[model samples]
Target: MTATVAATKAYDISGNVLKEDLRDIIYDISPMDTIFMTRAGRGTAKSTTHEWLTDTLAAVNAKNAAIEGDAFGAVARTLPSRLKNYTQIARKDFEVTGTAQKTSNAGMRELMAYHTAQASKEIKRDMEAGLLSDEPASAGTSVSARVAAGAEAWIYAPNHISVNQSAATTTAPVSGFATSPVTDGTATAFTSAGLNSMLQQAWSMGGEVDTILVGPTLYNTISAFTGIATRFRDVGSRQQAQIIGAADVYVSAFGSHNIVLSRWARATTVFCLDMSTWEVAYLRPFQTVDIAKVGDAERKALLAEYTLVAKSPMANTKATSMS
Candidate 1:
């Protein structure tokens, strides 16, 4: 066979081509805002043992007496109706593996993505869960014990008037209710009268329930509610189409409330919130700490030492049993 001239071959590395569109696409789109909680209040806890007193019960009475007849009569001193505690710590941690720390650069923070914004999201998500749940925390070995008097555990304590799913069952109060608390089952569909009654009851007791929070299921149910006023702009052009089916406001005889659909809220419950009486009492505001080096990995953690403060459980009402 005749010898041939030297042949040339090509390799992928020969070309200086740009990398495939490594566009970091993040799809985490759950509502992570502490909207209802923030609307309630914000404060700094003086110490790990944060305490606040709810105002005395509404007991003003009209009495018939001469101008000076009972002016000197002894009246009982009005003490704080209920005492509450803000003594819970919520925290999370984020660690970067040594390899990831040195070889990751897809998102904004590169290796610190999880440490910064993602870590914040993690903490915020948990806060939302605590804000919307009826969970009770029994101080862990690492965490402080919940104050036993009242407002012991989480933000949405079981103290609120929780209309149970079982209509026959009743929810007893941890302490005397601010007034006659709402106690009604919601295992079925929501009704205009039912909602109106709850609103009226709360309003009568001096609570301004200006917000109604619901889960996706109830959101759809509310959107379909006949009582919800539907407002739309007329698009005269036949070719133009408009989308509807959003419930932004609900006007009742008692008061008008802003309706909000929450992703993290419980599907079986709806909250009639008086945002003015809620608070996020921070023992230690959200901050990141750099851990001491224990391995080749770079370690960081997001920390938030805080607790929910429900000034008065009576100020809020919840409808449970929603299936």
Candidate 2:
């Protein structure tokens, strides 16, 4: 190909006037689902140290019959055991320069506004992970931050099951509000046997297990289990056929459980929970506030102070050491 002699070309010109072809929307693929947080109940906490009480009735005795017309005798009444957890503060903040705030952006009008929205989602993800973690509770000092025990910490004794751990044993927290699983042992595949055993234990303790939370790897393994309830979906003749490959609800001798995939759940653990027995106690609800300007920049913070409440630890179970 040949061009005309001394012809002006677009590339030959400098500082050409042309509009940029930038999209108006921003695409973010980060996950934002908070399964545990959304499913758990909500409550209010008045102090940094949130407290709750749990009581149990006396075990059934076949010889509980008393002699007819016997004189009444005073018996000591059992009192509830108190449990407490420290409230933790989670926060996310961002700052925008004065010039950046005033400058035009491709996808958003103001940078600060977009960052504030992002902070909210980030904090939520953090809370979800924390609530499901094995971190122990701590009554922090001025230098250290307080920490609330998580669901894994509350599960103990009969409710806690060890999978393929080296010692075939799991440690329980000293108290419902302090300490955590001392060891994770070894990792292995999640099995139906482990799951059923935990469910049975929880049921024996009067737990009404209704939900099962698992990570991605375990989620897929659970779907392949033979025990999953059979699912049949009705389809119209004209409509395309649908393939059902995943298991959403698992039915066992104990009860039917809703199987949920958690993006932030621990890879080696699964939680069998009675939603009614769990709560998120908030001393201070989520709030956004503007920080005082230091220079020619605007600052903002997203803050929340909350604690995990295991209303009835016996009503929940944890399966650990699953790779």
Candidate 3:
């Protein structure tokens, strides 16, 4: 598939080059991968790089849309929103602390906490069991309680993109991911002969997708090409949902028979081929480490621990943003 544009930047030896820069390459790792995470952290913290990234995403999206003649607004709105949400959530969690029966995450004064506190004050029945009692028909766990208690209310937001299924087997694939299919033009859909054509066009431009998520509609479309749809149905009947480090959306397409393909996306963690360096494994819902049962502390720790990243910024590489 087409190589992403950003990856083609000529080696910038302007940065500090060791006097003895003998450049012994690390096994199974990218040159930038060894430095981007730290660099990006430095970059984002600087504010300029972060602004550049937001703008770059916008420019790229606009250009892509212009060429395809599709509405760029969908992706334009999506990119900023996604980036803001990710950064905001990460920031809040990064500075959280709690102790004893009391707890505080982010700023306690945020108002969400106030409503929760108010609701808890009203939880007067069956303190020993620690579960909500069947005492009154008035109170419930719904957000309405918080709203009545003066908490602001908002709808449950929907994610813009979905992660397709790809085995998280040794490690979650991270690099050479969205690297494929870097073409600016867009095809309305990919199916039967159409997908092959898309792949060919992508190859003409460079490399394409490393993994993908396929809904039943798209799954059946790809199945006709791969011929593995029947094999998938015979054994794994339920959609083996994976809590991919990369995906924002859940693979709700359950059942082995009815399901056609897995939801996969670009990588969420550093896609290191060297398994030894990364002992951490991809998380699924009910695996040895089910993300579902994890408490806030555990979840934060989990995220901090396994968020494998190259030393430099992945943004330097073109990241795929779905519209």
Candidate 4:
């Protein structure tokens, strides 16, 4: 009644298997909310054109009225000036090979989810960099031409006040709309008094600078400023030595400003902005496209066509050339 040896033996062909739960986790630290340009201004692009125009006017000055029964004196009519800037569209594409996904056996609904997020992050990173450029795009082989008329390209409009304590050389001004460039400072550090002075200057020009954008070093320096002291008392029965520290708002002679720590900001420069006067114009909102199939398993691209329109540099001033 015994069975054959072959019938009793079972072949182990498929090896040990473990459940493959795909936890597609991404650990890249990207600039998620660096859209400072759109934070304080209107973000509407009505036209489908590649370039957008903004009308500007100089501050109306107060003048003495004509004397009663005196000869009629004439005043110049205030005309609106136009500022033209080109829109920039950035794209990022990614493709996955057919075999790569086929061989990898994992419980995943979408294979291209990670790639899409990466492409979107990169496009946004580049946009933040472009927004902080010192020179607006010029008419060249690669860049667009300067804005028409006397308007400074958006880049030139921001305050570029140099605070170099050393003998810094000056460079030719890029446009009549921009300030002349100065060499970096040889000084060691930035002082609180210096920041106060800059704020005062902007205040004198009727600018309510409500935001102070600074780099890491400057942010740390400001946080440690003696002028910004914290005096709070804990009234619990069991008092714990909790170190509560943060410098969110800075009160200056001009106005109170929120602090923004930026890693993308240029070295030796700090921007003080009113926020109400800045704008981001978008010809086309961000979109993803599926190109015609050529040879890839799956392909997609992300795009954002946008431009920065600074309403007036007078509303924003920067302290530059500080070490």
Candidate 5:
């Protein structure tokens, strides 16, 4: 129906007065899962360079008959070796202008508080990346920032296995720091056999494997392995049947492992970890502080000083350089 030629309509009015139709809720879909960080143990660190000691028992001998109690010979004793990693600082900061803070917002009531929370989450994500990265430890000079060795740097030969690695590229770090494995830029498909090999290596070293951490791609890849059975649920007439398509727990000869997926994990690497063998040493736990005001703005900083401790690197195994 058309309006009459002389009739006034709402569209004919200039600058119509109407309240905004914005919804009060805000939507965010960013992932914030830090599986490794959440599962690892926590400890306090007193100094910037945190240190821990590890010892190993002597190898077993098949022939130990000492002439049936002949003259007793003293055997040399071995001492525990000390391992150290420098603490790294991770931080995030945000500022909310005085005017913005006072404005009525649709999503959040307090601007500064919202930004502070966001900064905290961002720092956590940064730490997760740092802990899982292949970066080596460095006692930084005046010009560089100190770096803590990650799990990849500490995991060496006998525990660090790989698929399709170049010759002599997979070098173990000296004393669990200061070096990292070199990649061949080649990617190979992840296999159950490769994972089993890593698990076996750790088990042989007296490791009590309990968790298998992987990236999204490998997580899906493992779910499709033939070893994982197709799971079904029995339901009543009023219920819907459920089909479990993903493998959450993997059972092997070594042990049962809880498979954990991490968005921040390296796509080409998988860690078979005994959670007890690892720790995060924190010199300064995560905290927020207000910065000195220079203008009409409020600023805040979120930070933590932490380092990864491979209490017993041999107690963990990893498979790297895979697709």
Candidate 6:
């Protein structure tokens, strides 16, 4: 009898079902894994509890930054079902790395691991280098960066950040926070084809995307699709009806949703924990991810995404004594 050899890592079947799983992953992200700000008056509700996320997003990545590509400014507003398409962007540039449930390894899971590895590397490299506004030190090298602290693009960028040997002016989490003039993105005409197009654009860039900020109308349109699980397809009457049925988990999360989320100031920033949705446990301002000047371009790459790398480190900067 021949023994069947198994692959150490597996993936989540890479299709529509995997797409649903991806949405679950994001949804399952479980809101920052740590201490969160509460609505001032009540002080009871744990809204965006980003436990150690303060450090993760502040973390960095390893995938070589492509100069001719998006260069880190590749955020998009699209439907949730389209998450799968955006993942393929890392095929050549970076790969993910992570741990698992010890027993179960699936196809989609393998893919996720690759993405994680890339993210971790990015965080490590960025942390050591001061956050700067430039292309990663290298153009298309295979070296991954670490997670550190500083801000190039914000929102997802860590709140407590410094620039060019400057002072830090990190953003605080929004409790009763509200954007000045809430303007909506392309939320009016959400078509099935449009969602797919948008997802493809993001994936082709670099899996550097962390969140998809959208308006209520756009959120409604995305939440309206389901059934096929994670894949994105044309939404017809019957399809939307089926997809809407499977959105119970997602819809429930948004039940308490208000119009305030959509009102983010175009220029104003929001506080974000830097660690992964999971790493909320061991985050400090200058811990884990650290920044250093190794050489020329290598250090330059590290500097490009500082806030991304340092969100979790708890470096020299001190957290406002939550007294």
Best by lDDT: 2
Candidate that beats the other on TM-score, 1 or 6, i.e. the better one: 1
Kindly report which residue stretches of model 1 are placed more than 4 angstroms away from their true locations once superposed.
1-21, 24-31, 57-63, 67-71, 97-99, 142-186, 233-241
Please give, for residues 99-166, the per-residue lDDT of candidate 3 as tens digits.
42254223344333443333332321112111111111112243432100000000000101112322
Assess the local accuracy of residue 288 in candidate 1 as a C-alpha lDDT between 0 and 100: 84
**Which is the better candidate, 1 or 4, if ranked by TM-score?**
1
Please name the candidate that would achieve the greatest TM-score relative to the true structure.
2
lDDT, ranked from best to worst = 2, 5, 1, 4, 6, 3
Ranking by TM-score: 2, 5, 1, 4, 3, 6
Question: Which candidate model has the greater lDDT, 4 or 5?
Answer: 5
Cα lDDT tens digits, model 2, 1-323, are 99987998766654566556789889999999999999999999999989999988899899999999999999999999888899999999899999999999988989999999999999999999999998889989999999998888788765677765564343554554657543666776788888898889889888999999999888889988767884656899999987778888998899899999998878878889999999999999999989999999999999999999998888888877785
Candidate 5 ranges beyond 4 A from true positions: 3-16, 175-178, 229-238
Q: Whole-model lDDT for model 1 versus the true structure?
A: 0.63
Tens-digit lDDT string for candidate 5 (250-294): 888887888888888788788899999889999999998789997
List per-candidate RMSD values in Å: 5.8, 2.0, 26.8, 6.7, 2.3, 24.1
Candidates' C-alpha lDDT: 0.63, 0.86, 0.23, 0.60, 0.82, 0.26
Off by over 4 Å in 4: 1-24, 29-31, 35-38, 46-66, 99-108, 140-158, 164-188, 229-241
- Kindly list the per-residue Cα lDDT of model 6 for residues 86-198, writing each as its tens digit: 00011113312223323244444555444444454455333222232111222122464332212222222132222222333333323211111112222134443433333
Which ten contiguous residues of candidate 1 have the minimum total lDDT?
A: 147-156
Error of 6 at 47 (Å): 29
* Cα-lDDT of candidate 3: 0.23
- What is the TM-score (0 to 1) of candidate 1? 0.77
Residues forming the 10-long window of minimal summed lDDT in candidate 2: 167-176
Per-model TM-score versus the true fold? 0.77, 0.93, 0.23, 0.74, 0.91, 0.21
Q: Which segments of candidate 2 are over 4 A away from where they belong?
A: 1-15, 164-176, 230-232
